[model samples]
Target chain A: MNPVKVILTLIPFIWTIGMIPFVNRVKPIVFGLPFLAFWLIAGIFVAFICIKCLYHIDSKNNQDS
Target chain B: MSSESMALAIIFVFVIGITIVGMVPGMNKKMSLEEWAVGGRNFGRWLNWFILAGEIYTAFAFLGASGWAYARGGPTFYILGYGALAYLVGYYVLPAFAPLGRKYGLMTQPDLVEHIYKSRTLGILTAVIGVAFLLPYLQLQLTGLGLIIETCSYGQISRVQAMLMAFSMVAVFVYTSGLKGVATTAVIKDVVMIVAVVFFGLYLPIHYFGSVGGMFEAVEAAKPGFLALPGGTKALDVGWVMSTLVLTSLGFYMWPHFAANSFSAKSADVLRHNAVYLPLYQICLVFPMLIGFTALLVLVPALKTPDMAFMAIVQQTFPGWALGLVGGAGALACMIPAADLLLSTSMLFSRNVYGKTIGKNTSSESMGKIARVMVLVLTTIALLLAIYLPNMLVNLLLTGYSGVTQFFPMLVLGVFWKKATKLGAFCGVLIGEILVFGLILGKMDPVPFLGQHLNAGFVALVINMVVFVAISAMTYKPESNKG
Candidate 1:
């Protein structure tokens, strides 16, 4: 129900939709890595960020409660 | 043993070792019934993350997804899309249930339903529906394990023999560790599955078709539908795709094992944090589709069973060592989830149904004993069903999904809407489930009424919603109870 939380959650869903049409569009390089490998690694990094954000929010809420 | 058999033996031994560790008594040394069923409601964030990931991505996701892709072309991508969609939906619904689970120390979907409805008849009906649907779903995992063993052994071990071996291994761990066994095995399964999927997803396409572009080119040439959005005669048609996605997304959290795991978490924060990271677990699925796409290129038309597609590709294409590893990972994927399903359902049968109704004062030790015994009985029944059943793996899973989703109206409505009366909830579930089962068995076409391709689940959900809203509208509201 939190607007910020909802927006953050939508990030991955939107990212996934973008990747769909172009997933097969292979690139020679992304930061000196194959496109597929690079994309997956980047996604993992983003996931970590999201996890950290969520953890912070949850901890703050817990403190308040 | 042959070289392949020896490799499998080592993997099996490792799996058994983990299972034994899980079964050790002190791992879950709590006296309360809630502690026994839901891991004392004290799993940490890391454990919760791993457990939730493991439960969601079963051998079905690994083997079944690729198999679907190979057999059905682009339509199978819906599996990946649907899974992600389901997780997103769970993120929203899980928070509502976590507090309730903590307050009531609930263990199963029926426990929550019965609490809200306060009806013994509804409780029993929910349990029966859950167990019935779970039977085929569990059997599908067993069957997946059997195929993995049979394929890796190269016919030295028959499917039935492999199934028996895998089933016994699961039963032992589940009997010993209960949910603890499932949790430990899940960590191992997730590691193996993620590594295998990522490796294959990247390696196989390039290995077989030279590149992703080449893979698509081949697919377009052979089966144009593979490039189509919905894929294959619109097998992923707009309506079907949306319905399947929404149904499964809403239905995923309703599974009894998930509820049990949610309750097991140390705090509600653990649940929230775990849900945020859960999508990462599904990253493995992207590769299974690649494997499926690769299989279509390399495999001949004669080799086209939905279950065999992934296995056939590995056996025919990969080297002996790689094939062995894939097989081991596949078996672990199936075995971990099967153990969890078995243990969770046993806990449900013992604590929720038996303990609540038959013996109110059953001790934790007695309940644990009953749980182990039920594990044996349920696994035996599921084993028989797996061996004797004639349906394809994917179809069998859909049947279970549809049947289990009947509980959706009860759980989702019960928590969010205070106006939802106990009578309305019970009547809604009953009418919905009966109609759904009747349609499935009778193959009644609801297209006449809705003009859309409707399955048992969609039909049941419609009737359930109607009854719930109408009855709730008419009936008097109970005093504002927090639960």
Candidate 2:
């Protein structure tokens, strides 16, 4: 595996672990959303982006193969 | 009808409709035995993610996590804490299992273990333990469903009647759809649960306490320990937290439905993607615990069973329509896990025990038939257990965690280590079971070395690893099966 690919894979894992402690500390506002709402909505957004990235990589691998 | 009874009747009818609709896809498809048992090994990334999440976050997550948070306070955070770490760990571990699952056409954990060990006796042993462990877990899911019905119906519906109603729906769908039923219903359940969590997580605090911050502040003032880590009590110290995290994280994948879903993933990458994306599902839980904590703040002292906290809060805080929606979501949360467990238990009996041992040459149609029969049998057993001898939801779930984690050494290590011998695996498993049962029987109370409650799982894992390594070192190497 490429080192860059490995690091990219680690991003969500690291981000999630970091979020645990930060869960208690978030200031309760994001564009009118409460802190928990804002954080969860943001998580859904990140998940969407990650899914797209994974799809592209998988499709690219399929085309190359 | 009274308001609560009317609401419950509507929810039951809705759930039954969902289960029937979910069974349609599997009924239409003519699946071979392997496909029925393992989803034909063709699930895409998204389907696998939904199914895996549905399986892992069970009635336990809905009821047990909040209940623990309600009763034990900060100690219950270990549920999410361990689950997050488990996802990261699965990113590495599941890939190894994926390729092997694909290679052997394995349908259950026992198939994978037996393939590695080349021993039918070993296979049967693993199957027996897996079935034993899974039964209580399945019963716990049924018990959760029973609680929901009993609560919503205001005890008009007996627990036995409720379990039969719930488990029978699960049995019908699982018997018809197999893994397809589990996957299909999981998608619906996941969407419902996610929406419900988002709504309740945000709405309850604002509606009841003015804000999430206000809710937390009130809880902090009343039960200050609920907000702190490791809980405020000496019983839930830092050591207990660390031990629980380790034990549960290891136990996560040992779940039968997890193994079944792992087998169903199209590729290793799909499983890895699931591990990466799955934590997002935990977001649903954050609010449920808040709901439980809010109940602590708002409710009278006598109404304190953690199992009833969320329901009590909903009854007190919400209007009729909103309460119905919460009831529906909680019902789905409990039902989805119940359905998954029923399907997985059926697969274990048919594929691992019957197909591999009793009827080695069973045809695909016959195997599928046997699976359906086993689903009925297991559902009956779980319903009976739930009706007569139901346990406290949280402790019952913990007992399952301890039992399932006992398989970790064999399943996890067997895949990566070519040097893992059958004898070593057997010894490791034997000693692990001994320690687990011994601890359960009070042999290691006060924890021989550690002054903590000493999770039987952690002790069993230590013994398992030591025996596995020592026995493997002394035994001659087995011939490589791979070309």
Candidate 3:
């Protein structure tokens, strides 16, 4: 497996689990949204970027082989 | 005509039109069992995307997500977390699954299981369990369709009437066109759902609370702890959200329909692209949650049945014709996914359960005929369950997930770990399922297990992996396993 793709695959878990302990409170709102809501909303977009990166690496891996 | 009548007319016209269009592709083609069950092992990128999206984001997501948001609040964020988690797994796992399907000519989930384990008994068991779990899920869509029709008609039509009319049409289209029919309808269904969701998500908040930001402000003031985890519901804590997210994410791919859909992909690249971009649809899905929150403040007092939150909000907000369009979209959400579920369950029954036991030497033509009949039987059983055994939409889905997720150990480990023995796979799934049933029956799901209040499915999954690994170690016959 490509290291980049592996990292991308792990990103969603890391972001999801990582935010659990700290991002539980609803203060310091970002983008007019509460902290927890913003975290999940941002996480969705970040996950999109991460998956797109994985797709690129995956295509490269396929080509190299 | 009144706006309600006009809207109802639009919904009926759309449903009838889509049914006609949905059957067009399959009308021109003569289908074998493979084609009927798995789209003849040939679907390009966009078609596969539509089918998978249509399958995943069902009426439950359209309605239940909003309901959970409006009612449960913080716990609803679990929906957002799991979409990415599951798609990431799909990115790696689905490529592996597609090649196996192509290589073995596998047409369903149990076919792949039978291929991997080489155990006919286990294959049949998986098929039975898969269909059993899917029934409640199919019932969920029926309930959603019933909600849409009753709400749109301003109580003009009864729930039973709406369910019968919608599902009979779904059963007919699915029996005639099979997977191709489901895919073709999904294209229209998804497009309609996206439009309706976006319109409601943005419009509800702005109309009721001035803007999205203002909506959150009002929610914060009106209901304390509404925007955070461990919201009003005692069971829906931060831990429960995390546990449910992980379990459902892993469980998402284990659904028989999801895996079987992979067989239709034309290439691994198609699956990969779908995995990556599917999260975009997730972004769209979370909007309904926003609508739900807005509904809480806008719809005075509160709705008794929270699952009707989306429909209630749409009825209050949009005029009759637009409401009809929204109703049509919501109806499509239920029908498209329900059709796929019906197709998958019937295929599972015919290919694995009935074919394995009684019709072992039956020709493919006979099996195809059996599958078509099974679709009618399964849908009718689901309709009965919907009518008699009604439950909360998301609750039914979570229960279904807990049972089907048992297949994960056999699926993921069987692919990666060559040491995984067939005996281990069978025993692991059986124990996991029995434990799930015990937990649910005992009302100890999300109970204190190992000092953590994990979802019952995740708890069972842990026990399952341990048993599988231990048995595989004990049953180690390296040469026999290799061949």
Candidate 4:
């Protein structure tokens, strides 16, 4: 619920689904792949990190009971 | 033996082997309705993880992703990030429901609604809608099964025959073992599918074009527009990609069966942990799309059925036994989820509708029996429709996917908002379904003015949320009234 957590969550969303329209280009390929493909593939890893950070700080996810 | 016979033998043996593995757990027990539906809610992390991800990764993932990539191009990548995002949403929504699942011993999604709003009628309404939407989806698995077997057998086994065999096996598997069966079988299906997809996805592009980049460059040269959004397609523009992702990710866990499956988790901790790591599974989705893009160029004659790209490429490249592994994995992907859908839908009907109404005093054992009977009835209905009217099921599934997203308002508001009235959820869902079916059935999807790219279902969801909030505000009474 804190500002940091909220921003962390939004980071993945912005990269994965939110920024698709603006970045829908074939040129300026990253690492030998097209821009769109590179963006999508990298987005998964970004989501994984953001979710991992969110999980540790989340009050409910930490409860043992 | 002939090449066809060798492949057929391997495919059938592999399918039956995994079917028995699925049936091994919880055999020889008289399970109650709760036990039958959700493995008595004692599943540990690994088993819990498997079934949670199992339903979404189906025959559709194996063949359909490649098929979409082959036919639809850049549109196929839409499938990639949505699952990860769904888990992101689950990071919040699932923990909210975990205590409720344990506290009330809730068994189905309708049961959650009933408890949230304190209305049995709402429970019955959701159960009916859930079952209706699920049947069409079940039909899709059967049709997918038929295609896999037909391709595996080199046209020796008819699609109808494959479906019939799958139908019988799936029904009996669930009847004997329930959710445990689905989970155990999911292990084999996931393992074989990961191997097949990762290998083919990497191998094909590198084999033909010398590198992944080379393959993409070749595809770009061969078909210039094929590497980006709306690539080689008219309707699936940038808006389609963005909107479809939102619609699917929001609707992902709303399917009736998903709600029921979530009930089986041991604790909130396990489910939350799943959300963190589950996106790793998204890696498999990428492989299929790569294969699809590779298939676009590698085939000499080109494929007639776009959906056939995965199998067509597999058959052309591999030996009999290797192709058999792909075929067997695809069959399990179709069968296990169909079995789970049948079981959970029947449980929702028998428990929420039948037990709460006509069979008030029926024991959980009898309810399980009743659910079993309903399972057979539903399976027969799906089987007949799959055989008689295949396209009808596909259309219903499209509508069903969008229709279930309508539940997002009811569930999120009902749980988090607290003032969400029963009447509000009822009216909102009804109106949302109407808008979804109206726009989709009338073929007005993407709307006229929204660049023809946004999904129709996403449009309905926004409107549904507005109506739900407005109606709840009007109908909410103070706590003192407590009606």
Candidate 5:
């Protein structure tokens, strides 16, 4: 496994759940959502993009997928 | 003539229509045990996507989500994290499972455990736990269906009658169409469910509260911190959120049905490819929470059953036809997955229990037949529970969820760690499950030392990992029995 691919995969774990303790707030609402709600929703897209990039690379590096 | 009749009529149409949709494939061809239990292992993109979604989303998505958001506040966001994280984990893990499965014809989770440990007893133990987890889930579906129909039909049909009629049809379709039927109905269920869920999820906030932001702003103003974690209950804070997220994400794919789905993939590539897009579904979850938050201010006197928040608001506000659509979608959400769970759980009995014990020499055909019979027997039990004890599933759900997480160490370590042994795996499971159950049953969850910061199950998982690693090291001998 590429070290970068491994990091990219783990990013969501930190970004999604890791960021939770710090982002547990009601203010600084982004685009009408509470900051906490906004961050979690954004986390979903972050996960999708991260996985998409991983899939692109893995497909090229290994045919075994 | 009446609103109740219009809604009820539309729901009945959907129930029959989905059954027919599911039944057509199995009408002429006799679906093999292999086809229904493990799938044909040749699912395309749509079917793969449908299979995961079918297994994942259910009435819990609608009622339970919205209710918690409506009643509790911030902790509901935890729901969004677990699925995305589960997929993230699946991206790497499932591809591993695919090839291992094909080589061994691993049709069930117990089969995997059996293969990994070279122990039929551990396999039987897994089958027992797998069924234990599934029964609560199946009960949740039946009760969720009953609630949706009873509320949407304006109480014209009692919850008991709705569950009886609707779930019997679900069982019939499962009996006839098997896995292909579940897949076919899943495609349709998702389409209707998406449209209805999105519409209400968006419409409720916009129509009542002016905009989504306005809804949150109003809710936060009325109840400060309600927009953040621990907003609903004191027991749930950031630590609880963090710990629960750990427990659930690690444990999510450990469900036996997920194992079945992973094993049946045509290629490791298929499994990896699907993982990429599945996270997108997590975005839809935000809608239900939005509806629940919107209901918090709008509903006077609040709701008696927090789960009724989604349906109650829709029933009060929408037209009959719209309510019918949501009800129909909700029923499908419940039924399709419930059908899959029922079939899979029984096969656990027929394959793992019966195959290993009573009739070790039985043919695959006869095993499949026994599994089919098991579906009806299990459904009858679930239906009886749904009618007599609606709240039991909710109570068991807490322990049941944590109980499944204990399997994580066994599955992940067994796959990656060559040194892992059968004795280690078995002992770890036995001890972990006992400790987890003891803590939960003793009401020491959120665990005393950890306080309310960590989830009780995560504590168990940590211990499980320790024992698994420690025992495996002691038991390790140079390239002994691979099983």
Candidate 6:
């Protein structure tokens, strides 16, 4: 398995499931949004970036193979 | 003309224009089942983007997401959350299956199962299961179309009339144009939907609550706990949300249409490129959820049918033309997914079940003809079901996720592990479906395991894994390596 692929997949897990407890709170609003709402919006971006990195790694792997 | 008449006119014009867009691709051309079913395996990045978006973000994304937000609050986040997670899973899972699709001329997800397990019966079984789960989903699109049209017409057209009109047109275009038609219409649907979503998502918040933050603040004050996990609904809790997110995301691409659509990409890298950008669409979903939240806070005495929440808000807040545009977008959103589902279910039935068994040795032309007929047949069934056996949008989709997720273990194990036997795959699917359906029929709480009260679908998955591994261990033979 490509290390990059493994690492990238884990990003969604951490951002979504892992941060649920801490970010699940209603207080400590970030950017006018509750923490949970902000968490989801930000988690999507994080997942997007991870996928972007995976694309780069995958392209390189495709070239090598 | 009254504002309602003008809105209706705009919607009618948009619908007529897009119906033409849907048919133009395969117009005046001879297409075999191959071309009709998989777009001749020639989808480039942009085309793939449109098709994927069309398939993934349906009326469910627009209406259902917001509806859940308006009615239930925080659990609505799971929609986009699972979407992003699904794309992440796709980044690895889908690309792995792409090679097999191209190599074997695979046109459907069941075709992939047949190839991997070398079992025609299993392929047919997979097709049956696909149809079962997919009916409610396809029904969802048609139901959404009916809702959009009825709402736009301001009760000028009835729901049954709207569904019959929309679905018959969709059936014709899908029959004539095939996947190409769905793909083309998807391009239009997605553009219109993005504009509508962004407009409502942003405008509603700021217009009503001053800023997006201000909307959250209002909800937090008036309806406390509406912004947090498990929010205002007793039906959901943090564990349910967390487990559902994990399960749905993991099972995301297992939807038969999604798996088959993977074959539409030009190559694995095209799919990879799509995964990277697809989440941007999901991010835009935040706006719809915001719209839902705004509606919850602003619209007094909450809506009876929350599915109407988004459109009701549009009617209340926006002018006639804006409402028309939003309605047009919603209608197209409904049609795009409906077309894909119609094509997929028809193709699977014709190719996997009928062609392999009763109509063996049939020519590709004959198969294409049969597939078209099946498209009409399946459309009527879905339309009838949509009108007669109505359901909440998010509930229908969640039920679909449960059914389709049964495919996850088989596909994942089949690709990564050579030792996963055919018996294991079969037993796993059977047991998973039985457990899930049993739990549903019996009205039992999903067994508590792993510190979460897992849904029947996920619980069944764990047991299915156990059954698969145990059965495969017993049945293994060196001759099985022939697979």
What C-alpha lDDT, on a 0 to 100 scale, does residue B215 get in candidate 3? 85
Candidate 5, B67-132: lDDT as tens digits: 999888899989988888889888888888878788988888999889887889999999998888
Q: After superposition, how far is residue A65 of candidate 6 from its true place, in Å?
A: 3.6
**DockQ scores for all predicted structures:** 0.16, 0.13, 0.71, 0.72, 0.83, 0.78
lDDT of 5 at B401: 71
lDDT of 6 by residue, B356-437 (tens): 8999999988888999999999988887677766763444455577778888888888888777889999999999888877
**Cα deviation of B177, candidate 4, in Å:** 0.9
Tell me each candidate's RMSD, in Å, in order.
4.3, 4.2, 1.9, 1.8, 1.6, 2.0
Q: After superposition, how far is residue B105 of candidate 4 from its true place, in Å?
A: 1.6
Give all TM-scores, in the order shown.
Answer: 0.86, 0.86, 0.96, 0.96, 0.97, 0.96
The docking category that best describes candidate 2 is: incorrect
lDDT of 2 by residue, B317-392 (tens): 7655555665666677777777777777777788788877779999877887888788888888777667766764
Off by over 4 Å in 3: B388-398, B449-452
lDDT (CA) per prediction: 0.70, 0.71, 0.84, 0.85, 0.85, 0.83
Point out the higher-scoring one by lDDT: 2 or 3: 3
Report the lDDT tens digits of candidate 3 across residue range B352-425: 88899989998988888999999999888888878887864445465688888889989888888888889899
Instruction: Please identify which of the two predictions, 1 or 6, would achieve the higher DockQ against the true structure.
Output: 6
Model 3 over residues A1-65: C-alpha lDDT tens digits?
A: 66776777777787886677678866766776778877877887888899898888768877999
- Give the local distance difference test score of model 2: 0.71
Candidate that would win on TM-score: 5
Off by over 4 Å in 5: A63-65, B389-395, B448-452
- Residue-wise C-alpha lDDT for candidate 1, range B89-205, written one tens digit per residue: 666577778778788756777787777777676777777777766767788888878888788767667889888887887888776566666776778778878888888887877
Model 2, B195: alpha-carbon shift in Å?
A: 2.1
lDDT of 4 by residue, A1-65 (tens): 68989998888888988899888887776776778878887888899999998888875545764
